[model samples]
Target: WVINIVRFYKVYCDVEPKRQALSKANADLAVAQDKLVNIKAKIAHLNENLVKLTAKFETATSDKLKCQQAAEATASTISLANRLVGGLVSENVRWAEAVRDFKQQKSALCGDVLLITAFVSYLGYFTKKYRQDL
Candidate 1:
């Protein structure tokens, strides 16, 4: 009976260390599980942010495309307006020159009319040969 008691005491000593190791392993497992839960939550938050950023990027791209088209249209309009102005400016120069020519012709027309009337009256008293010479 005494030998059996000593053997049981030895077995109890061996099991004590194994029990302590088991407790430490359980504590480490709990900490690892908590860390895993926190990492998953962080991943979920990052995914949400990524979705929002992607939407904003798409909106900005569309806005940039619209603005580019508007700018192109405005440039086309300006080009057409410049061409129209160029045509009108050329026409203005032609009109001014024609007006100047008409004014000069008007000043000379009075003297020409007077000379024609005097010649017609003076030639009525002359023979055809003398009128032709005059």
Candidate 2:
């Protein structure tokens, strides 16, 4: 009984670290997913704004007053759109980096879990064999 208890304790100890690692990997994946969603939303908003600006530019008349006003609107929108594009590019880079890191961590944690499972199976086999021998 003492031997079985020791074996169980060892298994529990081995599993505990893997459980913690899995939790951390899950957390990191969630954070990366959230960042990706936010970045996509930002890109969508920028595209919508650009479309609105394009429509305004198309409808403007050539009269000096209308032309100047439209030109100013166009310029401002273009500038804002360009900045948004630049920001999106940077955000995409960040998202990509985060996804890569999260993937690596997830892969490593999966490997650890697999290894622990195999170790536990082997330990169980050994414990049973020992009991039979006794």
Model 2 per-residue lDDT tens digits across residues 32-81: 99999999999999999999987787666445578899999999999999
lDDT values of the candidates? 0.94, 0.90
Report lDDT (Cα) of residue 40, candidate 2.
Answer: 99
Candidate 2 residue 120 Cα shift, in angstroms, is 99
Superposed Cα RMSD, model 2: 54.9
**Candidate 1 lDDT over residue span 24-54, tens digit each:** 9999999999999999999999999999999
- Against the true structure, whose TM-score is highest? 1
Candidate 1 residue 38 Cα shift, in angstroms, is 1.4
